[model samples]
Each structure stands twice: as structure tokens, then as C-alpha cells.
Target: MENKIINFGAGPAKLPEEVLKEVQKNLIDYEGTGLSVMEMSHRSAGYFKINEDAMNDLRELVGVPSNYKILFMQGGGTGMFSAVCLNLMGRTGTADYLVTGSWSAKAAKEATQYGSVNLILPKVQKYTSVPRQSTWSLDPNASYVYYCDNETVDGVEFDFVPETKDVPLVCDMSSNFLSRPIDVSKFGVIFAGAQKNVGTAGITVVIVREDLLGKPMKITPSILDFTITEKNNSIYNTPPTFIVHVMSLVFKWIKRNGGLQGMYNNSLVKSKLIYDIIDKSNGFYACPVDKNVRSRMNVPFRIGCASGHEDLETEFLKLCESKHLIQLKGHRSVGGIRASLYNAMTIAETQILADLMESFFGNKKR
Candidate 1:
């Protein structure tokens, strides 16, 4: 455990160490089934139990209401771009999208093909702060009001839920899922890609309020249809059994550690440690995000002010890699350095990063 290298990648991020070890131990034979979960039939008893427990455990972990149906879907969060619009657009001819960052912007653009999409906030060149919601023009008659709870690339997060009044509030929580607790009843549909904080790639966790189901555009793919997938128990076809199995283990790990609140507390601790380095570094390091709306999950910063000191930033990344800390590079759309502190990242590992920033930049060692 002490020897494992720390990972700070955004998606396909680090999972709990214990979960990995348990999977490694059970890879050959699962519960005496004599077959690995990946090799078993989705319809088999082993797979059925795996699927059932995943749903129930997740419901309990998040306190999902009896009226909400938890469904594990595929095609990632991007797939849901179409799934969300197709399923809900039929309720009304339009929807309202609050575009704060890259993900929400993409979602809003996708909705245009299905019906009218009213972007409450126009796109910005650099998303540094979430504009006050008071400036937003929400359409009460729209089918849904959509937003991304956290934007991984922009390092922006909404500290409060947007009130949609009678209209349903839909959210894309792919990057920040499982890192904090949310009121499940407040959202009409909350979907997240599992790779960021829980489980792994290829499966998306979608919690939908029961009343929002059954409406799909005629072109909605059978696999992506929420109503069909839910009715068939997320086994409308061959499901990602291995990912679901891994997710079940991760949920148990979260519950054992301290549930969602515990994860939230840890996130605050980890992110604060790194942000402190940035905050106290003077001009050597800087974070562009508004302190209040800064993401506790993905922290994007620069080595030098304004556009960043490119040469120094390179040296800083090299120092990180040489010390066995990796995936610190920022997204191509916006270049700098990004540290994604997901649920599985340890404070000790985060302290290593914080220490590196202090020693490298604070001392002008470069």
C-alpha cells in the first residue's frame, strides 16, 4: 500500500486499494461459481445477485426515495447526452440548460437536435466563476432544467442546487459523483459515468425519479431508452457485469469508511491541502477559479500568473512524475495543471502533491 504510486487522472481514476485487491483475489473464481464475473452470463444467478445488490446498496447509500428507480446504463455520460434529451424532450418542446463549463455546453448543444434549448448563460472563454443564478432566465414551462454539478475541465462546481420550481431538475454528475452527499429527491434525474469516483468505465449510474419515465423521442435507441432499460432491470441486453460487480464493492467500501458524508469530508480535506499550497504560494502558483465555487474534486491551477509560466509548469510536471506522482497535466482545451482528487485518493498522497508544489515552486528550485 505504501509503495503504490498516487494517481490524479480525471476519469478512469484511481479506485480504492482494497477493492482492487479483492478483485484480484476473486478474478479466477467468484463465490465458488468457478467463473469470473466477466465470464458469467448476465442472466445467470451470480450476475442477477450482483446486479440486485448493486441497485439496493446504491439506493441505501444515497437514500434514494421509493419513487426513484436506480438504473445502471452504458455508453457513459456522453451517451446520456442523447438519452436525456430523447427521454424527456417529449414532455415539452424545449428545455433550459445552464452552461457553466464544457460538459454542460455539450449537453445543451445535443438537446438542440431534439427540441429548443435555451442556454441560461452563454459560453465563456475561460470558466473562472459561476455567474450569479439571479442573472439566469429559466423557463418554467420547459420539460427540464439541466446543469452539470461539477465541471472537471473548468474546475467549477455548483455549491447549491438550482431551483427549477415545478419543472424537473436534471444534472450531470459524472466527475463529482460519490464524492459528496446530495438530496436525491431534489433531482428528477441524476446521471454519472462511473469511471471518475466509483466503479470503472463502460457503465453509467442513473437515478431517475419514477414519474419522469416513459417519454422518449421516436428515434431513441432501444439500448438508451430509460423506460425499457428500467423495465428490463438494466439487462435490456448484455450489461457490464464486471463494472457492476466492482461498483458493488466500492459502495461497500464507502459505507464502511463513512458513507457519502465521510467521502465529502475527505474530499474537503484533500482539496484544501492542495488549494492551500496554491493560496499560500504567493505568485509562484495560482488557481484561476473563484474560491467559493472552486471544485473540491478537480483543482486546476497554473505555476505562474495570467497565462502561466510554461517553462516552469513543465519543470513542475516533471518533478511530479519523477516523484511517482502522475497525470497532472491539464486538459488540452485549457492548459495548465489539473489535480483530480477523487473519492479513493488518500490524504497522505495529496500531502505528497502539496509538499511537491511547496518545495518545487516555493524554493525556486527549478
Candidate 2:
């Protein structure tokens, strides 16, 4: 524990210490296979079983029904933006997007190049809270309704799933994936990149309802097609073997630590410690996100009451680094501080950061 540093980066965030130690212990020889997972053939039984376990454990954790096929694809969430449009847009030629924050906005923009994308709610200058569903224009006949459950940038989160009735719902859960329990049956497709809460950054986990497979646009690449990945058991080509092994390990760790409900409870505690400090800080520490819609995974706040505190913000980040806290800087689009509380960041470590924020300034409102 000497010279320990906590990583609060949004992606490729800190992983569970136990998982890391396991990997370190087996790096040279995985499962007595006589070769590293990195060097093993993707077709080999060892790597294939690792891939299968990760998918099965994740499906159990998130409650994905038997009707959905889980595929481990490359290119993260950005690639899925194009794949979504390619696969589903042709079904109805138009999709509805609820652009709550940066990622959703980017997804909607990418979708425009493929088919008709209707922004149900007008874009806003400030991406603080999710707009009321009543204000949205619901296109009942659209192919699907897309939304980011938790926006990593902008710090806004949807507390409830949007009801599309008969229309399928697509979600990008890249940031908050596995942080809480979800009813997978409600969604047509649910995708998440592994780096945040699962493992490393080479792969993305996509769960697609079996009924929605095989109908991609003609331009869709075979690699990006869900049917192809599903048919091949998510190994159409050589997958990221090492990352998949790590993912499988992380999945077991989550299971051992009491599963999804356990993760959600820990999230509440870690996030509350930070929010409590901000709330008590008066105006010295300011959170740009709405109180109700604030994200548990990513908390973004400014240091000088949201106006003209650029110098103070920099100083604060420097001070945090001194305390062995890194990646607390907020996104450039919204300048401030961001504390990412992924699964691996322990509750005690979160307290250390919270205590630092508490001592940063007086509780009196500026």
C-alpha cells in the first residue's frame, strides 16, 4: 500500500486489486496452459472458455434474458454509433434520439449520415438534466429510440428507462455498465465498453435481442453485423483474448462481491461522500448537474461557483495530484473536476478524496 495512487480516469479506470493480482500471478502461464493468454490462439479452448464465462456471468449480473445474444466486439462505443444506424435504421428508415449529453449528441450526429434521425428534444446549451419525457416528440413508428443511460461527460444520468412502447430501445451504457442492476428484457440492444467497470479497453460488450439480428443495412460490414458475431459465438475473427480473460476475471470478482445489487449499494455510498461535501461547500464547490439527475459513476463539479474560477480549478487539481489523486480534471467541454467512482475504486479511497474536498474551502457560500 506504499506510494499508492488512485486512478479516477473516465475510461481505462482502476480495476479491482484482486483481479490485478490474479493476472499478475498468472501472466506468464495462464491456467497451466504453458503460454500467456496474449500468446494463446483465439481458437484454443482456454481463450474460448474465458470469452464464454465473461458473457454468461455478465448476462446473469445484468439479467439479460435467454433471447439475447452477447457479443464481444472491438472499437468501443464510437463504433457502435455507426453499427446501430447500419443495423436498425433500415428497419424503419428513421430513429428517435434523446440527446441528453455529449455521447448521445455524437450518436445522433453519426446516425444522420446513415438514416433519418429525429432529435426528440431540441439541443440545449447546458446539458445538466434530462428533459421531461412529456416535452419529447415521440415517433411511435420509428425503428428505435436511443439514449445514453449515463453520460460520462456532462455528468447527467437517466434514473428511469424511457418507454417506447412497441418501439425498441437502444442504450449506450459504456460508463455506468455493471454499476447497477438492470432489466435487460426492456431493451432491444444494450451495449457497453469494458474499460470503465468491466476490464480493459480493447472490446465492447453488446447484448442484442435475438429477434433483432440478421437485418443489417447492405453496407454493414460483416464484422459489425450482429448476426455474424452471434452466429460465430462472438468470435467471428480473432478477438482480444487477453482483455476477454481480464473481463472474465472481473466478472467473477463482481459475483464474489455480492453481484449487481452489491455494486449499486457501493456506488451510492462512494458517490454520496463526494456529493455531501459539494452540498455543504455552499458556493465554493459547485456541481453543474441537476441534483436529481446527477450521475453516480461520474461527478463533475467546478471550484469557484461556476464562474471565473479557472485559476482555482487548476490549483485544486494540482493539490489533488499531491494527494495521489489523478484524473480528477473534468472534460474540456465543461471545465471543472470529475471524480469517476467505478467498481474498483474502494469506498475508503473515495473517502480520502471527499475529505480533501471538504478541507479545500470553507463551508460558507461565497
Candidate 3:
């Protein structure tokens, strides 16, 4: 294995070494242009192609159909929180949202600023699992239904695609984007912050259905309007050039690694091994997410205590850090441990983590 430390960071997470090497190679001079990607003008052909390639690769990777317009915008996923409301609020009285966890709750909160929000907080105690859809209180005439496909903070995920008909379905895929194959056609909008599976921070990706464009609510900013940005090819203003370039490199890496299906297979193996460790640990280590709805990309588990026990968890994290397994801390909202297994995380790294977990937990299924 490589000598570099094993990275388990949640977002701004690990990227493929091959992509890093390519970025390094182009850091100084990009394709004999005598300028780094950072130095190039956003309007220039070189930078334009970089943006186009990033979008095109994402489109192909997710099998985005002709109906969807891919836009690389600034302001991350939070931007979309307002953007979604601004664009769709005019259609109906309120927006419907599933309050699965923190991210979705934040989305619901943001939507309420523009209009009334009908938050569907599924009843499953302590954010431990996703409730069955039969129990979800979906609004029939709602402008749109918003949900976070995976909650990074609480480590809960929707194992099945939500069932929604004509009402547009919006998803905050920030924590779980591109970690597995998805049906792009089912949703009216899907947005992700680039920091997770894409490349770096500072950029957001929006895949909006073509039919859903053209009419933002009166309060919507011009830049936030999907139709306006789509018309301008996401170049309405000087876009995040450096971030887009890095995203393009990452996209190429994903293609090389066999696209979405490959990501699905790789994620399955890596996450399964880690979850297996947690599952077999008995009470020694416990995964908070319900087995039916656990996120394949983000796994949050408790070691040696209930909700209030932070000391032992911190010690375990420090021990893991000493061994070069980094960023296993859970989000502040839900205290425990979190292991983010993104596309760039290798199977071997997870194997090492499983071995460590085994060794640390008395070498027996707890």
C-alpha cells in the first residue's frame, strides 16, 4: 500500500491519487498555455472546456437525460436551499419536505423563509433510521417535495428512491452524491456540493429538469434562477474556475474508475466491511442508523456508551488518528464516530479500519 495516511474525512474528503497527480502536473502550466488553471480567464476556451467537461462527465456518469440541464454554480448546497424555494414557491402554497436529519431539516427551514413549509419529520426515534414511506406525510398540492438522500450528520439514508409523481422532487445529495447509481429522471432537481464526491469545496452542481426552468419566483435572484444560469451555461459571472478545473480532473478519474456502477460496487465493498465490523461488535460499537436505511457513504457509530458518552469516543478517535485513520469524528449535532467512505476511499483502507476495530474491541464480536 501507499505510505500516505488513510483519509476518512467526511467532506473535502479524499480524492483519487491519480487525480491528485494530474492536478499537480497541471498546477504550473496547463497544456502549454503558460498559465495555471488559476491564472486562466473563465471566458477563455481552455477554462470553458474544463467546465463543459465537468458537466458532460457528470451527465454521462449519472446517465442524465436530455431533459436535464447541468449547471455548476457557486455557493455550495446551501445556496440551493434558497434557490429551490425561490424557483418553486410560486407554484403552490407550501413546499413539502421530509425532515430526515440535519441537512433536510435545514432545507425545510430555508424553504419556510420564502413560503410555508410542510416538514414531514418521520417518526423514528433519535434520527436512528429513515421511516417507511407509508408513514411519510407527503403533501399532494405542495410546490415541491424536498429531501436529503443521505444525512451526513445523523448517518441515515433512504435505501429506496422516494415515490413521487408529478410533484417535483428535490434532493440535497451533498453527502452522498455519486457514491452510487441513481435514477436522475425521477427528480425535478438534484443538487450537490462539490466537496464530497466531486472534487473540492466552493462549487455546487445542479441538475434541473428542462421543463422546470424559465420561471423563478419574483423574489428569486437572477443568478439563482435555473433558467438564467442554464441559458448562460453557468458562466453568468466568473465561475469558480479553479474549483471547476479540479472537478473536471475528478470527473475524469471517476470515468477511469468505471463510472457510477464502479462507484456502486466499490462503495458496497468498502462500506460493508466497516459496517460488518460495527454490526459484529455487539454492544462494543453500535451503528445508530437503522440497518434498513444506513448510508453507504457515511457510517456513524457509537463506541462503548450511550448518547452522553463522549470521553471514550474521543479516546477511540485519538487512537484511530494515531494509527493514521483520520476524521472519524461525527458531526456535533449527533455525537459519536463517523466514517465517510466516499468513491475515492479504497477497499484496502476500510479493511485496515476493520482490522483496527477488531483489535481495539477485544478481537471478538461485541
Candidate 4:
């Protein structure tokens, strides 16, 4: 197989090459069924096994407790913004949201339509670091406390999970899901769009505590109701069959590669390779995020001077592409460069990027 350009996009990011190879091998005829897994019926036994194995593998990987119901839903994390509000906000008419970055802010905005949203932390000009938990004015009467585990666009991650006391802690782990080990028992609802570290787009993995189900608002759609979806085992209607199959393969790959701990270890090494380069480049490479809250999944940095360096940033991106490194461009909201070192991104690939950055800065200095 020819070498492919490294992918560093935030979502729909790179899949393990071995998993892709397995999919290619089975794309034409899956397990001698003479039909692609995508072409197979969702109700078929083969597909049932696939879905079951995926869920079981995920549970094993994350050490999810027996009380949590893992539901593979259709909508992305954006959809969960409302579903979480509708389903879980009935306990209290208000939900407290920690606005750490773009996704969490959007989620808080979406929740306002279903219930009142209390911003636990004041809005900031840039999401550089998570606010101290002590400073947050969390509502004890709120239904759930929502926060993003990792801010994809801003590249800020929580060094410690927020403690909400009696309030259920709801987390959107979209960008950094499966990149590290998490205490599943602490969260009431943990949802992630599969496009990131899991598989592809079209499926969302939702792990909700059993107590959180059966409590949607009166106007909640049947599809968005966790009770109904969990009762049917995430197949009340036609599911994202192909995406689930791919995700099953991803689960297997994660297990083969040593589960969550292994992924976490690799994440540290890969992220450090780039962060080390940025820190050692004097002032050439600048990371806006606080050192303590820097994300291991996404590293967003700027080239050249901090201000009025668009030309240098553009030239840096072009040079990266020429070296077969792609998707290094940052999100439009915070324009610069973002290197998403997902689970599939190898140390070798990260080294190439670090070398590229060093060379680019060396050349610019000359």
C-alpha cells in the first residue's frame, strides 16, 4: 500500500490503518455472505453480533459500570445537546452548563429552548483553560451539569473532572472520547459523535446511567427518548448499520492495542512530541492554551508572531501539505494550526510533523 498523507482533522479523523484494511477486505463479501456489511439487513444475525460485540467491547474498554446503558443513537453530539436537555432536564427546570469552549457553549444555547441554562462559568474571549471548579457557581437544584471533556476547537481539556455533588454530571466527550481513561460512574450521561476516535460519522455513542432514562419531557420525540431507545437496544428504528460495523472494528482494534490505557499512553507520547516542539521553538510556535489544560487529542498552535501573522500561518500550512501532512489548519474561530493527534495517529507521523515544524521555523529564522 502506498503511503498516505497524515490526517489531523478534528472529526471524521483518521481510522486505524489495520481497521481500514479489514473493512476493505470485507467490503465486497462479508463473512461469505456474498454481500457487503452495508448491504446486509440490520435485523440479520450477523449485524446483531456486530452491534453486540461493539457495545461489549466498548464497555470493556472504558470500564463502564453495569448501571450504564450504552445506546448507539443516530444524531451527532449536536443532537445530544437537545436530547440531553429534553430527557434529563425534567428533574429540574434548569440545567447548569460550563462554557469552556465552542461545543459546550453551543450545547448550553441549545438547552435554553428546552429549559433554563445557567452558565457556571462566565464567557471568555478565548477558551485557553478550564476555570477552577471552586469558582463555578453550580446550581444545586439543576437537573444536570454539562461540560465538554475536551474542547476540540480551542484545544483545552480539563485536568480534573468537575465535582457537582448531587447534581448529575453530563459530559460531551466528542473530541477526546476513548483517548484516555475516564471514571464512568461519575457521569450521568456521556455522549460522543463516532466521527472522532470511535469510527465515522452517522452514529453517536451515548452511555446514560439507568436512572437518567424514562424521564424525557412530555414533548420529547420518540427517537430522542432514551427510555425507548435503550429498551430496544439502540434499534427502535433502522440504525446506522455501516457506521456501527466500522465502529465494531474500531472497538476490536482498541482492544487489540491494549484498551483505554494503551490508547492513553500513546496519546501522551504523540501529543508531547508536538507540544515539546512548540515549547522549544522559542517564540516561533505559540500555544494559546494554558499548559496545565493543554489537550492531548488536539494541539492548536500559531506560527510566527502572535498577531498579524496570517501570511506566515498560510505559508506554514502550505509547506505542511507539500510534505504530505494535511488537515493542520485550525478551526476558523481560532485560526492558526491544529494538529489532532488522535489514537490512530502514530508516533512516527507525529515526529514527521514535529520535524516539519522545526524545519519550517529554522528556515524562517534564516
Candidate 5:
């Protein structure tokens, strides 16, 4: 097999090569069941084992509390925006949202349809930094406190979990899920689309506190209702069998590679490699996010000042692509280069990108 390109794209990002190889080996027949995982019935014994193993491994890997139910549902993180409001907003007709970046802002907008949304922080200028918790205008009667733990587009991450007191803290952890250790008990609801760190695009993992269920708004669909999905073991309808199976393999990979702590260590090393380059570039590369609140998973940097450097940025992306370092371009909304150092990204891959950055900058200086 020819070598694979180093992928740094964001979602539908990169799966472990080992997991991909395993899937390739079992694509034709899954454990002598005479059918591919894709061909197997969702209710079949083999398929049931796959689902059970995925959930069990996930629970063990994350040390999820007994009170949390892990539900593997379809629809990406965007779907959960509405599901969160629908399920949690019935308790109090209002929700408090921290608009840290684009995703959180979008979440807040979606919640307004179901109930009142309190923009805890003022309108963000460019999503460069997360506002301090003290500056937030939180409402005591809000149903839940919502925020995106990692803003994939703007590259801002919450370094510390916010204390919501009695209110449930719901996080959209799509880009940074499984990249580090998290206290599961601290948050009432944690949901992530599997495309980032988990597995593929079709599956979304939602861990909801048991007590928070059965409280959806009257118009909530059966699929988006947490209580129905949890009671059905995340199979109220046919789940995303192939994606869940792949995610199960990923869970195994995480265990073999030293679990969550190991993933965290690797992420730090990878992110630091790029950030170090950006910081030392002496204005050649500039990261907009505050250093303390920078995301270890996604690092967005511009080629020059805030005004204009479109040509140089385009050239940098082209040069990186020529070296087989792909997907180095940032989100169009942000207009820069973003290096998404996800779990499957190895230190060697990061080093290659770092070396390219150094070479690119040196050439520009010369």
C-alpha cells in the first residue's frame, strides 16, 4: 500500500492506521459471522456485541459515572444543538449560553427557538479568546448552562470547566473529545460528533445524566428525546452500525495506546510543536487566541498581521500540500491556517509540519 497523506482537516479527520487496517481485514467477514459489519443486521448477535463493547469500553476509558447514559445517535454536533435545548429547556423556559466562538453562538441561536437564551457574554469580536466566567451574566433560573468546550473554527478552548452551581452544565465537545482527561461527573451533559476524535461522521456520542432525561419539550421528536434513546440503548432506531463499530475499534486503540492520559500527553506534544513555531516566528506567524485559552487540539494561526496576507497564506497552504502535509488551511470564516492535532496525529507527523513551517519562514526571510 502506498503511504497515506498526513491529514489535519478537523472533522472526518484521521482514524488510527491500525484501526483502519483492522477494518480492512474484517471488511469481508466479521468474526466468522459470514457477513461484513455493514451487511449485518442491527439486531443480530454479532452487531449487539459490537454496540455493547463500544459502550462498555467508552465507559471504562472515560470513567463515566453510573448516573450518565452514553447514547450513540446519528446527526452531527449541529443536531445536538437543538436536542440539548429540546431535552433540557422544559425544566426552566430559559437557558444560559456562553458565546465563546462560532459553534457556541450557533448553539445559543438554536436554543432561542425552544426557549429564551441568555447570551452570558457580550458579542464576540473575532473569537480570539474566551471571556472570563466573572464577566458572564448568568441567570439562576436557566434550565442549563451551555458552552462549546473547544471551538474548532476559532481555536479557542476552555482551559477550566465552568462551575454552574445547581444548573446542569452542557458542553459540545466535538473537536476535542477524548483528547484529554475530563471529570465526567462535573458536567450534566456532554455530547460530541464522532467525526473528530471518535471515529466517523455518521455517529454522535451523547452522555447525559440519568436524572436529566424524560423532560423534553412537548414538540421534541422521539429521536431527539434523551429518555427514549437512552431507554432503547441508543438503538431506538437502527443506529449507525458501521460508524459505531469503527468507534469501538478506536476505543480499543486508545486503550492499547495508554488510554486518555496518553492521548492527552500526545496532544500536548503535537500542539506545542506547531505553537512553538508560531510563537518564535517573530510576527511571521500569529495566533489570535489568548495563550492561556488556546486549544491544544486545534491551533489557528495567520501568516501575518490581522489586515491582509491572503497571498502568503495561500502560498503556505500550497507549499504544505506539495509536501504531502494536507488540510492545513483554516476555516473559511476565519481565513487563516489551522493545524488540527487530533488523537490519531502522531508526533512525527507534527514534526514534519513544524519543519515545513520553519523552512517556509526561513525562505521568506531570506
Candidate 6:
């Protein structure tokens, strides 16, 4: 098979080739409709069906309950950093956040500007382990307990859902959404940037519990208000038409790939290959995050090689680039190599990467 660039970039990331092929087929004439999905009116029947199908497929993929509203809103996850705070903070006096890494910290920081914010920082002995829940100081009266679910920067993920009651749970699942199955019932709100698993940038999907609507503070912008968006079906404005169209293709791609079960199994295989290589590589490579909280979606590893080769990641990335492997660099906040194995990543591509890692380290040992 042709091993073109293996795009492991996180967000604005790679998409399934099938999805792209489908888009290409329909780009000029979408299902006999007169216009491209982009050119069609957002309120038009054809376009509305595209929107509806996308939401329905998402609902099926995540097992979203009937009571939840799947909203396709503009702005990335950063927008919801304020939107969630605005809509939910009025219900209770304060908002609580779990600071797993940079994203959660920012979510908390933004929320603090609106209401009393409590930030929960995990107790880390090193960059290697996640703090147990017992170690976390959680507040009972907080409006909603917010967490990143998966930290894209630090490569840390909550292996299991946190146990809380009588409070709504909100999660920013940007990087890892649809990477696997999640218990959607546990969250009062789940928002993700489409750039990651959803499809592209410019659109954010917000899944909010029905009851949580209509509680927006008066200061909340009418567009940012959850109640208003829900009422208008997430089309208060023109909406991100082009992005939504691409997202529909992605949603259809997920369904065609055996739905969630296929995605779950594929993720397990891809993640296990990389993690096992890291574990078995005899300390030549290291995964910093604790194994328990390891993010299967984003695998960040450090390479230890001698002779100015210590900065081997730069060279490794270059090598991968030569072989058409793309975007293997880690985030700036946590410097190293991060391989984002989102749902679109195929097992064959990951195996190619695994072989590259092995060969790279084997040569280093020589």
C-alpha cells in the first residue's frame, strides 16, 4: 500500500480517506441537489437534512439520550470555555474545574472571570503519573464539575469517570472526542472542537442536558446563550455551513466504519501498538504520563539519543517527514513528540510508525 504522509497532527488533523473521497464525489453535485453543500442555504431542506443526519449520527455514536440537545455552534472549544461558564454558572454560585493540564486550567481561568471558580490540580510526583481521585479536593456545591476528560498537551486522560452527584458534569472533550465510547449520561455538557475527531475547525459541538438550558445569565451574549441556540436549533446565525458539511461527511464515515464498536476496537489496537513499543523499548523511549491515565488518542514520547542527537525528536520528525509522516511534533507546552492517533488514523499507518520507532532506537543502540 502507498504510505503517503502519516498525518498525526492534533486538531485540524487528518481525516479518513473515504470521507474525503465521498466529499469529492459530492462536491460538484451533492446528491442531485442543485448546489454544493457549501452553496446550499442553511435553512434549505437538503442542507437541513445534512445537519440533522450529522447530529443523529453523533447521537448514535455517543449514545446520547433523547433529553440531550446536540448543538452545532460556531467558535472552537475556547468559545465554550466562556459559553459553558455563562450558561451554567448562574445555576450555582461557583464552578469547579479539574486542572489536568493547560486546557482545563484555561477553562477554569475563563470561568473565574464570570463566577467563583475552584480549580482542581492533580497531585503529580512527576510527569509520569495521574493523581488518584481521593487525592483531589472536590467541592459539593459547585455549579458543575468541569474537567478536560483528556489533556491534549500533557498526554494525560481520565481513565475512568469521576464519581460525583447532585451536580452537573461538564467536559471539554476536544482532542479525544469519538476516539472511543464515553458514558454521555454522566456529563451535563460535553463540548468538542471539530478540528480533532469531529472534522474541522470553526465549529464546536456542544451536547447539553435538556434541563441545563434557559439558565443563561443576562450578561450572556444572545448567540452564546445555550437556551437561545437550542431554541433556534443551533442556527441563530448562518452557522458554519462549510465546516458542518465536512462534519457530516465525517459522521457518515464513522457510521460506515461499523459505528462506535469498530472505532473502539481500532483505537485499542492503534494505542496498544505504540504503548507496547514504548514499554518494550528498554527505556530508550519514555512515555511521561502515568500508564493508568495514559491518553490512547495522543501518545507523547521522548527519545534519548547521544551526540546532539539528544534532540533526536527534531531529526526523527524530519525522517518521518521524508517518509511522508507528518505532524509528529508535540505541543509547545509539553515539548517532545506527540503522535495523535485520532479515529481517522489507520492501524497500518500506526504499524509503520511503530516500526520507525523501533528502527530509530535500534540504530541509536548501535
**Which candidate tops lDDT?**
1
lDDT of each: 0.92, 0.91, 0.86, 0.91, 0.91, 0.85
Q: Clash pairs of candidate 5?
A: none
Stretches off by above 4 angstroms in model 3 are 1-3, 122-125, 306-308, 363-366
Give the runs in model 2 whose Cα sits over 4 Å from its true position.
Answer: 363-366
Alpha-carbon lDDT of model 2: 0.91
TM-score for each model: 0.98, 0.98, 0.96, 0.98, 0.98, 0.95
- Model 3 Cα RMSD, 1 decimal: 1.7
TM-score of 1: 0.98
lDDT of 1 by residue, 1-366 (tens): 345688999989999999999999899999888999989999998899999999999999999999999999999999999999999988888999999898998899888999999989867788888888798889989999999999999999998998888999999999998888899989999999999998899999999998989888889999999999999999999998999999999999999999999999999999999999888877678888999999999999988775788898998899888888989999999999999999999998999899888888757944
Error of 2 at 235 (Å): 0.8
For residue 120, give model 2's deviation from the true position in Å: 0.6
Badly placed stretches (over 4 Å) of model 1 are 1-3
- Tens-place lDDT per residue, model 2, 159-211, is 88998999999999999989999999899999999999999999999999998
Q: Supply the TM-score for candidate 3.
A: 0.96
| lDDT per residue (tens digit) for residues 216-325 in model 5 | 88999998988999989988998878888999999999999989999999998999999999999988999988999999989999996654399999999998877788
Candidate RMSDs in order: 1.2, 1.4, 1.7, 1.1, 1.2, 2.0
Report lDDT (Cα) of residue 341, candidate 1. 96
Error of 5 at 44 (Å): 0.9
Steric overlap count per candidate: 0, 0, 2, 0, 0, 2
State which candidate, 3 or 4, has the greater lDDT.
4
Model 3 clash pairs are: 281-366, 282-366
lDDT of 3 by residue, 1-366 (tens): 544588898988998899899989989999899999998999999988898888888888889999899998887899989999888878885888888888887788888788898867644547777777888778889988889998988888888878878899999999888888898989999999999899999999999999888778887888888888999999999898988988888888888888888998998898899898878766788886778988889988888844535776877888888888899988877778899999889998899888888888884334
lDDT of 3 at 157: 85
